[model samples]
Target: MVSQSPPQSHQIYPDSDGKPMADNTEQFRWIVTIQQNLDWLFAEDPNVFVAGDLLWYPVEGHREICTAPDTLVVLGRPKGKRGSYKQWEEAGIAPQVVFEILSPSNTLTEMNKKQVFYDRYNVEEYYLYDPDKNDLSGWLRVDRNFDVIDPIDQWVSPRLGIRFSLNETLQIYRPDGRLFLSYIEIAQQVEQERQRAEQERQRAEQESLRAEQERQRAEQERQRADRLAEQLRRMGINPEE
Candidate 1:
């Protein structure tokens, strides 16, 4: 039998030498929310996997390095856990969609640096969301260059076949007309609907039991009256007279 060699080691620096990374609560929460939403949405569509800030290394000879994005979508990778993403390990495929949610801590230089990194790695799309001023921007990789796409109030992802819309509320709707909300919102709504349905079923069952008991009582009373009348008739006291 062939023996397997030990896996290669990778280096992880807590900070990029004072570089800005996903280390704060606000950035962390947005990433988590987006990831959970995408997970539920793609459960029925598993070809794509979405992840929040994780390490990714793009080249083989160089010790590749990356951390989770605000949200990242890989078109063909199986959804699962890993210490980090190694480009060569993934058939030389990088994430097709990468998202960055802007926070006060992020500077233009840092953001631009990531843009160049993703571009060199052949990422197909890059999207950014800024909650501060609600700045939403998107870009597509074209001919070895990253070109910005005009912000669309609504658009469709050719990769996942789902529509992304920014109405008064941000919503992602599936083709079957079902809506996918953030994990917290989806869980709360499902719980409410379940409670309502259970209450209705209980009420209906109670009403059925009540009606059955009343019918049985009425029948018993009628039989008792008949027996008393027969007893009086047999006693030679002419009740009719």
Candidate 2:
């Protein structure tokens, strides 16, 4: 009998694309802000998956056809740690939303390719923001093609329920109308809340102290009146009268 050879393993899909997550600090900041905020928004839901700068492979054996999105949101997937998002392994559910932050190093051609890739992969929503220029662009999938979102300013994402505003700068608001904040801004807010809480604690303590003092004074007055009444009674005077 001839020995049978074992089947070869499939292609390996690397987690990283060997590229930095962001070319500059601005790009990095936007990426983190969008990803973290989305994470916070869907924190109560177990079916939303949010990742930043993670490679995504849309095909099973074709690992070469992959790209790492700045921010990728998969609504139907469970929240967990993944080295890379393999569409085949994810119940064949493509990432529904994606965000890209433009840096000085990004070229128009490079961005165009990303758009094409996302469109072909069935991305429901695509948002591109250029921090330096304060320009924002969005694309929403219509049928099988992505349509350019005109008057993109103040455009609310159907899937994400987040509003994008481009006035002095790009501001993204959550469904609850909370503005997306950077890590620094979030830290500052936390510090302010902590200080406020401390002040409130101090005020409560002071109020308690004041109440105790008032109670003590009232008790002392009552005791003094009782002593005077007893002396009057001992001297043959009716204290009540």
Candidate 3:
């Protein structure tokens, strides 16, 4: 009898789905702003995982069941590099928060499919922003189903503790009341902070130098007075008088 070979397992999903992460500058900016701000907010947390444009595989043995979210946050996962987020390999913890930035190329049908996928995959919070129209929408999980949040403006995210305000444009505020900044804005703020720190350092050094000078002046005056008293005593005069 011929020996039978074991059946081959299905191949893993590709990291790249042959689609660009963003279609234009505005879309890319939104993606980066959301992803980077979230990263900054959770930088100190060891278990918060933030990823942008990373393919997420939610099912095992089905390579086609995957979607790449614009920005995703997983609360229980460790921070690290991943080619793709395979749910089975991640201890079955789905991303708790997902952000989608709408581009001009996105169609209603495409967005509907994405919404269904996220809802079925157990995402706790879902946010969508349209930069061109200045529209913001959100959904929060209730009774194991995602429900639309009416009047998304001034909505606060439960998991992140960040607030979303939509006026002329979408604005996100951190827990500490700082606005979510773009890449350029963040860099400028860093530079300003560096300058302020440098100025503080210089001021401290100057204060230390002034204190040393005052101490030296006092020491010199005391030495001169002592010398005069010694000379008077040497000349047979009552120095005390």
Candidate 4:
């Protein structure tokens, strides 16, 4: 009989990397804005996956080789909840686009390391933004290397198809020319829409009430005219005359 080998143990990939998602409120806002907007943009597509601060393991059995981007967009992946992104389970497809929002605590070396990691892992587009300084940078993978994008201001991302405007502050616009709104802004807009709809409902109700009142008045007038005609006939007078 041939000797049987023992089954290998499965490796564990932890979801959390023991680091906070953002260092400050501004950083958090930007991260959420980018992630939520991307999620909204691809909401109709079942195959697009958007995640924020989710650990991604590019290699199996080597959980140490992982990096979590502030925001990541994967084109071919399905949208769902995942503890972490395991490349092997995802058909070896890597995230196509990634965004990094800078915080005060972020050092140059740390950002550079993130760039290298992204480049090595086949990231097609990489963008970084400093909200305080209104600075933006981007890179596109060309010829198997990360190429610096020139004139990043007002530059449209090929994958996302969104325009970037860097004036006194950073603003991102969708393909439909709508600004990418933050969570608070979206909430405020929803409230405004709700109020407008409520007003419209109230106006419709008032118009309907007025129409009913007018109909009632016309009916009463008809009844009075018929009564007068009957009295004229009873008095032996020609009602028609």
Clashing pairs in 2: none
lDDT, candidate 1, 1-241, per-residue tens: 9985334553442322234445567666667667776777777665676776666778654553564566788878787766667767777778988888888878899888888888878888887877656666777877878887766566666665566677654556665666766567778998999999999999999999999999999999989988887899899866578
Residue 185, candidate 2: C-alpha displacement in angstroms: 1.2
Worst 10 residues of 3 by lDDT: 4-13
lDDT for each residue of candidate 3 in 1-241, tens digit (9 for 90 to 100): 8985333255647899999999999999999999999999999999999999999999877778889999999999999999999999899999999999999999999999999999999999999999999999899999999999997788889999999998889999999999999999999999999999999999999999999999999999999999999999999997788
Candidate 4 C-alpha error for residue 33, in Å:
1.0
The C-alpha TM-scores of every prediction are 0.74, 0.95, 0.92, 0.94
Model 3 Cα shift for residue 108 (angstroms): 1.2
lDDT of each: 0.72, 0.92, 0.94, 0.94
Candidate 1 residue pairs in clash (backbone atoms < 3 Å): 53-68, 54-67, 54-68, 55-66, 56-66
Q: What is the lDDT of residue 50 in candidate 2?
A: 95
| Prediction 4 global C-alpha lDDT | 0.94
Q: Which has the greatest TM-score?
A: 2
User: What is the per-residue lDDT of model 2 for residues 1-241, given as tens digits with 9 covering 90 to 100?
Assistant: 8985333244667888788888888888899999999999999999999999999999887778998889999999999999999998899999999999999999999999999999999999999999999999899999899999999988999999999888898988999999999989999999999999999999999999999999999999999999999999999999777
Quote the positional error of residue 54 for candidate 1 in Å. Answer: 0.9
Q: Candidate 3: where are CA atoms >4 Å away? A: 1-8
Q: Alpha carbon lDDT of residue 201, candidate 4?
A: 100
